[model samples]
Target: MLKKYSATPYVIWSILFIVIPLILIVTYSLSTKNPINGQLVFSFSNYRKFLELKFINVLLKSVTLAFKATIICIILGYPMAMILSKMEAKLQKKLIVLFILPMWMNFLMRTYAWMVILGKNGFINKLLSMVGLNLNLLYTRGAVLLGMVYNFLPFMVLPIFTVLLKIDNNYIEAAEDLGADKLTVFRKIIFPLSMPGLISGITMVFMPAVSTFVISNLLGGGKEVLIGNLIEQQFLVLNNWNFGSALSVILMIFILVFMAFINKFDKDNDDKGGVGLW
Candidate 1:
């Protein structure tokens, strides 16, 4: 049928882009060059090398920063999303445009703007020096973490906002009719229904935070070297594709595991009629 063939383009695109690239990466991760003839030979040396403490530490640091950023995004964005959902629709659109405006700019430019803002003798430092106090704010872990939260806050807000907007007021009314207070309605209904969007927001924010090189590079000034920086060095600077691919594979695996865990938690909530948040 014509309907069946309509999907052929998508199938071809996935095979060319997704399937082939993943295959190539896996092949590179499981291979090394033969010293004698300079040919790729099957091996696990790269993954073995990943077991080194330094590499493991980098991975741990990346995950830690990402986790912290995700938590902060959730804390800040959830209330904002709730407020937006309650606003008049026209005002909500205007506020959303304001939030999304920054994202339309280049990402590198945004990070550079942060560098200028956070740098010594930059805006904050200059303001402080006017009061006879100066502080070193840039090139710190906190600055890098703050940058991640700044860039990704919209990702967290929009998903939760979309989900909140879809929540039927009739459900709240029915719960209220059953003698449920506002707090009880939210605890037993609203929060649980919002879990899908929360999970999506967490995934969106955490994945990029874990793998972002520019934010760490610019804001942390190479002081906060993350796994992404190492991978970048291997591929672009050092020209070591095998090791770079190995690192990429490991990072992919860790991300997949985190996604799986989030999905499982979401599934559990759905199985419990979305009241598992209590």
Candidate 2:
């Protein structure tokens, strides 16, 4: 009875939301354009078009940008997580709030805020002018990267911080009592224990950063077109739902494969150390 009830909601929700929509998308991707009727008919041509060199280039660029952003988040967020973990409970709570406050505001509003700060003749440029310096830093690859990092940093920090908080202070004290230095204690004890958080942080940051559209759009000023932008154009602007569906499928598969690989790595690590991925 318990099993039947549990399975019923799962089946209904999956069919209503995930399965139904995905089936429709796949159907669309396999369909051909009927100019006479303005409807799609069954064919494999859309997926073939996705393999064109120009399309491939756009997908690669998006992947590159996402990967770079994820790396930067790890580099900056890990140390911040460590510091937060080591702080007094009151201070740690305040810092966590500060990290999360940006997320409470609307996402586009935050992106627009960055635009005001980073645009030509914007706040930062004005400050630089005060110091007798001139800079034009907008609409570049660097701006897009900065936008991605700013938007996604909280995702990375929260997961890593949660993981670090789970680690007991006694382990660090134990290492120190054994005459281990700070670096040694961290490398040998703290870092290993925080692996779960690190994995969670990587997944949290990488997926959204990879597929994020609005940040790359408004901040990139249409000059930088990532895969998300390409997909958006196909679906919304060009009225080529078939091609857009194929692109969406490809991106979904890419994320699934990447996550599968990460899960396998976690499993291997777990068998070796008895660590759980939280």
| Lowest-sum lDDT 10-residue window in model 2 | 269-278
Instruction: For each candidate in the order shown, give its overall lDDT on alpha carbons.
Output: 0.93, 0.85
Model 2 per-residue lDDT tens digits across residues 12-37: 99999999999998888788789899
Q: What's the TM-score of each model vs. the native?
A: 0.96, 0.93
Instruction: Give candidate 2 regions above 4 Å deviation.
Output: 2-7, 274-277
Who wins the TM-score comparison?
A: 1
Q: What would the per-residue lDDT of candidate 1 be over residues 1-278, giving only the tens digit for each residue?
A: 99999999999999999999999999999999887998999999999899964699999999999999999999999999999999999999999999999999998999899888878889998899888988888999999999999999999999999988988888899999999999999998899889988998999999999999999999999899999999999999998899999999999999999999999989987876653212
Clashing pairs in 1: none
TM-score of 1: 0.96
Worst 10 residues of 1 by lDDT: 269-278
